[model samples]
Target: MASSAAPAPPAPAPPTPSASSTTLSSDGIPTLLTIPALGIKAPIVVTGTDPDGVPETPPFDRPDEVGWYGRTASPGSQGASVIWGHLDTPKQTAVFLYLRDLRPGAQIQVARDDDTEATFTVERVATYPDDSFPSDLVYNDPGYPALRLITCGGGFDRATHAYLSTVIVFARLTAIGSSANGSGTGPS
Candidate 1:
């Protein structure tokens, strides 16, 4: 008689985008973040939060998309623009998987709904475990227009069967330009 193998682990819960803590800019148009190197692009949406003041996970249907907190500072504003996406999914390719391979000075572009594009360059890359996640350092940097691209990485855990760390690509705005309705945000 053949023996049965152990069942696979349950999938990790989807990340919740913060609701109450998020801050939006004066303009209602959400910022669009694009990683040309990885061909990943998505609109940052506004979310509300819980009574305990914790951010909620983003919706599951659009795991490949990245969400920016409207409450946070914009790309060109005073604080770092936080952007989050998923790593590989159980069935399909997820955006930002190659974010770990991005080198310092790599280009990151953000296009506002108002037709303005801000170009940023990678400055550093870091990894953080889920349990000890650094909320303030990653999202509260008030330096030059900064950008952080986040996703899961590290070897898959056998016990947890999920990614061990969150890969964060830290970049700063280097240039800004404008575009017409359809031209798109390209380098000047």
Candidate 2:
């Protein structure tokens, strides 16, 4: 039987924090990314689309790392910031192997080179076939700081040696700087 529980309506994204004024005007080069809910804390590596226009993935030898697409908005910027990772290697599970397990309202923290972190709240997760991936929705600027984390999912094809679909986690910036429990020691 097909599972109707694949996903229900996602809980509303957590409200934007109002107590902190640490929002930066410019982009911050993301260095590290964390998802406490999933126990993921991985170093980020820069990548870009190949000449053929496919976004690059982390190297096979470094499957545990994340790839930040340089052509898109950096975290903390008012646009779509994209990050990607491998679902697995031929030999073992990789960094984003369990990406589909993340639920709405989960937090994703990206620590940047500017010493500030952009915290995003999960809005929803969706999956689509690679041939039908929504580029306009996934790549366009949404007029606010947003994030898109992508990876391969669904049944792996032995003939093509690839998964048949892409999993995307859409998030919106909900916190900046630092202050409260999720933040650091600042004036409260």
- Model 2 C-alpha lDDT per residue in residues 1-188, reported as the tens digit of each score: 00111111122232233333434445467888899999999999998766555567778788779988777778876667788888888877889988999999999988888777788889999998767777766777776778899888887778768787888999988877631234632222
Q: Quote each prediction's TM-score.
A: 0.71, 0.82
lDDT for model 1: 0.60
Best by TM-score: 2
> What total of clashing residue pairs does each candidate reach?
19, 0
Model 2 residue 61 lDDT score: 82
RMSD of each: 9.6, 8.0
Taken over the whole model, the C-alpha lDDT of each candidate is 0.60, 0.74
Q: Tens-digit lDDT track for model 1 on 6-121?
A: 11112212233323222223252446777777676776665434354444434546666666654555665446666666665655556666788888877887777766676788
- Kindly report which residue stretches of model 1 are placed more than 4 angstroms away from their true locations once superposed: 1-28, 48-52, 158-161, 181-188
